[model samples]
Target: MTDPIRIDVWSDIACPWCYIGKRNLENGLAVAGQDDDAPQVEVVYHSFELSPDTPVDFDGSSADFLAQHKGISIEQAHAMNDRVSQIARDQAGLHYRFDIQQHTNTVKAHELTHFAKEHGKQLEMTERIMSAYFLEGRHVGRIDDLVALAEEVGLDGAAARAALESDAYLPAVRADQEQARGYGINGVPFFVVDGKYGISGAQPAEAFTQVARQVWAEHQV
Candidate 1:
């Protein structure tokens, strides 16, 4: 059997573009898979916190946070978020409710994804957490909330709770961050295909499809 093409993605759950990129990558893979002899692919998500110092219960809205973080006016932040939201809806069919988003430190959420990885539910957990945060305006920083999300993905809620409370996956989260640093990755939603091809930002589906085809063809030769 041919080896699957491995894709390592560094993204944060709080990143709007990361979610859009996720959908685009999926769509791109689906397009590539239309061929009967298309190579199989494997995706591994890594942690990259966009706002590591953000409080679990932030005192301000996402717009306020963005304004301060980017040195922009609150109105500008709102406008920017609106533009991105419109793009997400039109391009990826993702409904992002930035107005109701609960911005928080995503370390715990990242750790929860690592725990889910141990049980082979990492992808499902990541999707559920991102959807909860971006679409449902749910709080993902708290342990109880994360455990609930784990259960939603068919993981053992109690074990998840224990892991979170004890910080069992914290090391893994840190390791992922350290690896990101090693690669000099300063942005979220970065993709490293086969540990070499680097694609940054929320690129279109065609970009991913092209990379997949190129990498697979190179391997076959």
Candidate 2:
């Protein structure tokens, strides 16, 4: 049996491109599978907080936060987001509602993802949280909100809440960040394939497809 390709992904809950990159990678893998023998794949998500200092309840829209963070005008921030929104819609088939997005510190959300990983619902949990943040405008920084999302993904809500309350998974989140630092990765949505190859940022589906095929072919040789 062929060994599965392990992809370690570093992403943040508030990152719009991370969601789009996830979709593009999935789409690319699907395309590759159709063109050749489908390779088994294992994806592991790690924590990367783009704005660790952000408050749990930011007092403005995503655009306002972006404006401040990037030191740009609110109008420029909106224009930047507009371009990204269009790209997300066209490339990843995702509808982003940044106007209503709750810009919050993702450390707690990252902790929840670690909790979900322990329960074998990491992927579902991550996807749901991203959707909640970018699409549904749900709060992801609070324990209560995260627990509700965990339940939506078929996890035990109470257990999730308990885990968050106890900071049981905060270590795991910190560990992931430490590892990212060792890897010299300072950005979200960074992809590491098979412990060697690094693909940064949100590339097109073709890029993922090509990389998957190349890595698979090399491993077989």
Candidate 3:
């Protein structure tokens, strides 16, 4: 059997397209039969903060944040979010209620993802966190909130809290950032396939399937 294809993805919970890209990747895996009998493809989610400096309690709306950060108007932000939300619904069956989204920094949440990886629930926890942030209106920037979310994913709440309180797994988060920088990654939803091929943004599932097939074929030789 060939070695598993390694897929490293850099993303942020606050990034709508990251979530979309995740679904699209999953769709690609399903279509390619990579999820079934092919050489294994291990997925690793890395941290990339879209709003590292955002306050725990953001006073403004999502539109405001986008306007301030991207220099776009509120109307444009809403339109953009609407388009992405519709895409997500079609692609991932995820219903993103943009009005309910809580805009907060996700540094600590990313740290918790590292912790969850140790427990073999990294992907589950990542999905949960993203859903909490984008759909359920959970506060993702605080340690306490993260602990609660961790518990929902079958992790020990107290231990998760302690880990967050002590800055545990922070180095791992930084390491992810450093690795992205080394790879010249400047955007979220960046996918590196088999340590060589790079696919950026929320590309279609066919694109991912093509890349996966190419990488798998190369490994077979």
Winning model by lDDT: 1
- The top-ranked prediction according to TM-score is 1
* Tens-digit lDDT string for candidate 2 (1-221): 77889999999988989999999999999988886576677899999999888999999988999999999999999999999999999999999998888889999999999989988989999999999998998999988999899999999988998999999989899999999999999997999999999999999999999998888787687
Which residue pairs in candidate 1 have backbone atoms (N, alpha carbon, C) closer than 3 angstroms, thus clashing? none
The Cα local distance difference test for each model comes to 0.93, 0.92, 0.88
Better model by TM-score: candidate 1 vs candidate 2? 1
The residue pairs that clash in candidate 3, if any, are none
Ranking by TM-score: 1, 2, 3
**Candidate 1 per-residue C-alpha lDDT over 91-131 given as tens digits, one digit per residue, 9 for 90 to 100:** 78999998889999999999999999999999999999999
